[model samples]
Target: MTGIALPSLPAEVVDQAIDWSIKLTYNRADASTMTAFDAWLASHEQHRQAWERVQSLGGRFAGMPAELALQTLEKLPEARLRRRQMIKLLSLFAAVGVGGMGAREVTPWQRLLADHSTQVGERGRWTLIDGSVLDLNTDSAVVLRFDESQREVELLRGELHLISGADAGSPGKRPLRVATAFGLFEALGTRFSVRLDQHGCRLGVSEGAVRLTPRDGTARVAQAGESWSLSAREATRGTATPQEVAAWRDGLLVARDMPLAEVLAELGRYRHGHIGCDPQISTRPISGNFNLTDIDATLDFLAQAHGLRLNYLTRYWLRVSV
Candidate 1:
């Protein structure tokens, strides 16, 4: 349920709730402790309600990799959590999703209510009102803002493969732009793909050209067959093959001597939880065509091909080691 649906309880009840959470999570509660907790719960309806909220707060940890989840929770400000853990409970009143609670992701309202969005391990497409086709890759969000003046798409996260459509009424008069946190991608009759993450945005142009204007006010042009690494201030040109650019769209990952760590990171995009690489073998070069939709097959392939080991800490946590 949304936070608005949950009523507020007293501060003391909330404190007890957090205390119970820490004890149960970090300590083995003896029979006496359980008995005491039960009696406490029975003593006041607010206590029971607060305990329920505490449990619900952990709901976001469900299905998360054990280590990743624990690490994220550990990153929570210790003093802040101890003092206001109840309010910090994502289920209680956090406006953002669990992603923001501790995982450090930004889920803006624009992305939350985007015209087109997809979850992890999901791929989808949408035909905009003006007939443009947008293919969204896993864990992606894109918002389309089209009006009488222009056609605009804002990519909040993940990646997008866009095929611009003509403005049937007056194609010449309509201008199209794709905006990211760092800058703008102005379409010049092009087909392009864009991926965004903590580092910045990676853009590949397949046909025609794109003019990018970074937040720092520098402008650069990327033509066909060229890829650009765009950060907040500038765009650097690079090489990209069509197959390399379009592989994920066809449910495949194309690696051309990419680092094992890089490959694992790319594959992690399609799988939930953590796909970790041992520091010992992360620099190993890996090159192959891998299926994107079958994560198990990919993992199996990695193990068999590279003589690596897959250690499953939990269904949600995996460690690849040599």
Candidate 2:
């Protein structure tokens, strides 16, 4: 049901439907509340459409206890959802008479609502009206908002690389900013890469500079040849090479003493399904340049060179051991 294609409805109407769902399913609504909701539903055809789509979100959790659903939502390792986002999602689930969910599970629907998105193993690039170049890594989604007042890119998921260009609008040089779940990045005519995962948002500046402001921390300037990791609470500075910063642009993965498990995890982003590493070899240091275009060949190389075994449980599932 979550995968059902739905008719497009206005954003406001969708929000209303979600709110109504929460009130009706999660709370003991008074008669007035029910009456108002009924009126809203009957007021417009788009409202009905929005409710139909949002209600499907809870189909899987409909039978679970509320406490159990909440526990499941809290334990989603891959979602790395913030506390606020988690609460909102929980409410959304409660609307459809369920509760447990993860951001990863909901991300596909989000991408469907995005202005730009890429499928698994596929990358994307676009030239903005301001002449800036925007690139999306595999399975990424973003919304571009460029108006007279500002130019903004909202990163919904995965990673993005951008090269800032002069905005020659009437007001001139509208600030180019990228908004992620963790914080905001204001570009300063620079080339930078940003990745959002369960951990946080990682920023690598290859050229010029970028101003990084975590949601709860003070602002700071990140110069060229610097890397920063930002969470909701703070920002940590790090180092990265130019090659490493822009490697994905050239279809290469540069592993600088990276862990075997980590390498497999990165490769998994380019290919579908699961790639598992045995715990014994998970932390083994691996260093090499691998081609991202052909993930299977790289996995084969790693298996033969490192004296490991590849167990193909299915075409969509592979395990590396011994």
Candidate 3:
């Protein structure tokens, strides 16, 4: 799939967009090149939108490390690279825009056409066409690609709880499968939640069973009340109490003796911006059920109860320290 077109964008389109980006930003463009670029835009309405979106990527990198981003930018061919363009070029290198990337990150087109998606701090559930329910966690997305041959759901990001549904159109029960970058999960008439992270996927099963097939190794099956971590190479069986798995759906952030850093990371998902703690406090373990809907109030109360200081650099940047 490396050379193949992204599910949301054609290969030629991405190549052409990249070419245009380079011409306008990195390379000197003559009058003829400008005319040709305009002609390309006239050729397809999407080309114009692509150019706009590409030009808009630099601001996202403002917080990135200067040395790391600059080093990457210096490798580019741009003679006079602006700060914003550096980040935009970084995005290009990381396969953020257009295609060339994996299926984990949802493309712009996918989001526009996604049957169901959620924004930061927002959660939702969708009753699928086949009568099953798919619950989306905060800042998540999933795409449904069902057909006469198979029923499949692709997890783009974040987490989801998928309950197997009945497809009346099929003679037998339709096979329900969830796909992610780490592996493929096939449901055996059960209920489960899948969380996508940087390295792999975490799966929690409350009822029934699921078989996980890693990209490079043997498949492993977890029974009801079981959990597992799936990487590209293997599935490591783990434990996740059903309560912990379903707590988010109930508007609570439940952590049981989990490290303070991880707890903050979980809380950060429901709130905006940088939420962190001092290195000395990072290892502290916390256990509680906090409100998810009103996270700021919860954090404020917890700061008082835990004898911690809530530091706010700005409305978006927050830190909890002892």
Candidate 4:
């Protein structure tokens, strides 16, 4: 048996080539349509080497269920998945050359959403078309889709802070809407924070107003400097100051005599691990401002001031005890 000789490609160049090839494959291409691609490839030895590295990138799709692959790829950590795909493709290219070119078709939305999730402990700020801005907190995921009729954002997971944009040109433009686990929040040209926690959903209005309609019949209107929680049964509204609601944006978590357990829950969102109060300390009162960026220092401060002890089982797990 005769084996095809493959050219040596630098690791970086090979990676770029595989990425481009995967993109092209998803865009739709087959083995026989390589006339122009071959010409382009031969234009430079580097290009040829790159193409060689990328041609076999889709072997993972072989005999693998397309739906499973798509879902698995979507859930895998982006960096690690991409690296593995690149390595697989490069290996095939080195073994079989450009003759192997069977790649699965993945939709653009799947690719886009798969690429846009936030990293752990990382927050992001983005601007919308209507001039309003959005701040995504750590470990959050959102999908933005705009059309001629309306602008919509789907909160797939995690939390987001939205500042509604005023009507720019169209007087009766469709109102900006945010969909989440709690329900749908319709902004009345308002600024608010929407968070999804294990228990339920929380909304804190900073400026303007917001209308909350739950999956159930319960509904409520939240005004400036107000907060609300929506659950499966009902919506609860309360008066909360703007400073307290917006504190996280400035890298601080401020609690005003809140229960120790609740404060630990909020702090856990900004950290990589489980942060919980000891059963004995669950009812303790927690106050003062804690830095969101430095969880360790904040924990240390809590220990020094309140006689709480910081305990760590792993880098990703934390607990507070007597």
Candidate 5:
């Protein structure tokens, strides 16, 4: 048996193709639709590749929870929100333009608008159209767009905390939603946080209830003090410890017998520099509450209290030694 080969497309072209799909789906595509689309796909072999790349963009909508995506997408402001975003992008272009560097610097908002991402150690916060708030942890990114019928937020990277609010005018409308790497978390007027890691994703509910439905079909309900880790195929339930989860918001680092490697990973989120532990020492247990504002002091305390030594490869790279 032979496996079918998938087509490869350039990412930029793929993004443009998805933008075209959004325009077409929203009735923003002009009468030159077919002509323009055909010309676009015919421009080069890569153009066709790009079109094929985006052909599956709407696959999530097939048999998708319409009510959920609708509510989520509707929370985003109008397209006019792009104006401010574009201005930011223009500044980057101007800087590159002045520097005479042909290379372009892509802003987080542009990649975010086009369904891209943020690099390591970057955090962002955004307000939804319905007055809901979203906070993206370090290295996080999300895509948002609102239509007359819905509000939607698609997590592209890292973790995001969402606080859903009551619909200002439409009292009986569907609830907002957040889509992550592992599954969909439908916010029912609640406060929740979802984190995506290399292993999979974790969801922790702070208040109210959230429906956790896997992209593959299985579903579970998570309430306050509950947490679950989900992969594409399964979900495992765990107890939610709010102090551990919310510690970041308070500028503190709290861990409970977590592995040294994992502790370092969390610490990395608070600083612009790098921190890691020796692989042999990674399995060592770590437990403590350290202030994030002074990471050097935190590291110093770890060495004094835990019999560990901190080594700096460079100002930005750190590692733990025994």
Candidate 6:
């Protein structure tokens, strides 16, 4: 649907309106809650406008019954899923003044709103307030949470390389940690990289040790020169060498006699589209260091080196055949 552009609303106002909607509509908030909302609505005209826009947004949710605004959220998981729904609602609010949120653009809302993030094919490095160095891989997002208790990096999406700083040695004695969907990794003055995939979180430790605690499993210490795949239940050792694993930090993809299909899959993550190999050649061995800074050129080089033909239905859809 074409959006009707209205006067731009403040992000905080939109969020407040959404929070109120969630409490009032989904939570069955009490009379006292309603009274508080009333006072908030009357405090400023912008609040009223935000409410109107929220109501209008509800109308847009009519057909898509799964959205939080129209959901019977009482039946859903309370903590993580609830926050996920709220983010989804916020994304819808953001899409209002622009054109409708396209199907392809739905998943990146949280990433786009993160404290630190990189777009597709982009890599970035940053220094945290606590003097730590952070390197974000393509399509990555992270949020920092620092307090007296701990210094935490919340990996919302994609992969990251972190070198723990001296925050732990400070007066408050805060420990440094990284949180992923599967579990938390507490650093011991370590350098580590974490990548999230469908199965679980993949961790590569190069410097000091880190304590790995799965959400529902026992904690284990991952020592230097170790790579682990941590799911909610267990931590499995990975086979890749330390160099092959961390090569992306130098803008390279190191395929150590990796399968052709596997190579393509890794390359696909750095690009916009599907990169597939013919089934017959999918298991063929490929080995080399390729430049990730230019993916198309890398693909062309691979095709030449491997004697594979490239078929392109569109620039975004590519297939490799023998």
Q: Kindly give the number of clashing pairs for every candidate.
A: 0, 0, 0, 0, 12, 0
lDDT of 1 by residue, 227-293 (tens): 8888898998877675597789999999988877778778877876446566656668888899999
lDDT of 3 by residue, 184-218 (tens): 99999899999888678899998999999998889
Q: Which parts of model 6 are misplaced by more than 4 Å? A: 1-107
lDDT minimum window of 10 residues, candidate 5 = 97-106
On TM-score, the candidate that comes out on top is 1
TM-score of each: 0.69, 0.67, 0.68, 0.61, 0.61, 0.67
Candidate 2 is scored at a TM of 0.67
lDDT of each: 0.71, 0.73, 0.70, 0.64, 0.61, 0.72
How well is each residue in 79-162 modelled by candidate 2, as lDDT tens digits? Answer: 334455446656666444432221113336548878989887888999988988999998889999999988899998888999
Q: Which residue pairs collide in model 3, if any?
A: none
Q: Write the residue-wise lDDT of candidate 4 on 140-223 in tens digits.
A: 778876676776777765677888776485556777877776687888878998877655678888888888888775778888
Whole-model lDDT, candidate 1? 0.71
Winning model by lDDT? 2
Better of 1 and 3 by lDDT: 1
- Badly placed stretches (over 4 Å) of model 5 are 1-124
Model 1, TM vs. native: 0.69
On TM-score, who's better, 1 or 3?
1
RMSD, candidate 4, Å: 16.9
Provide the lowest-lDDT 10-residue window in model 2: 98-107
Candidates arranged by lDDT, highest first: 2, 6, 1, 3, 4, 5
lDDT, candidate 6, 189-272, per-residue tens: 889888877558888899999898998898988888988889999888888755577789999999887888778878876876
Model 5 error, position 97 (Å):
17
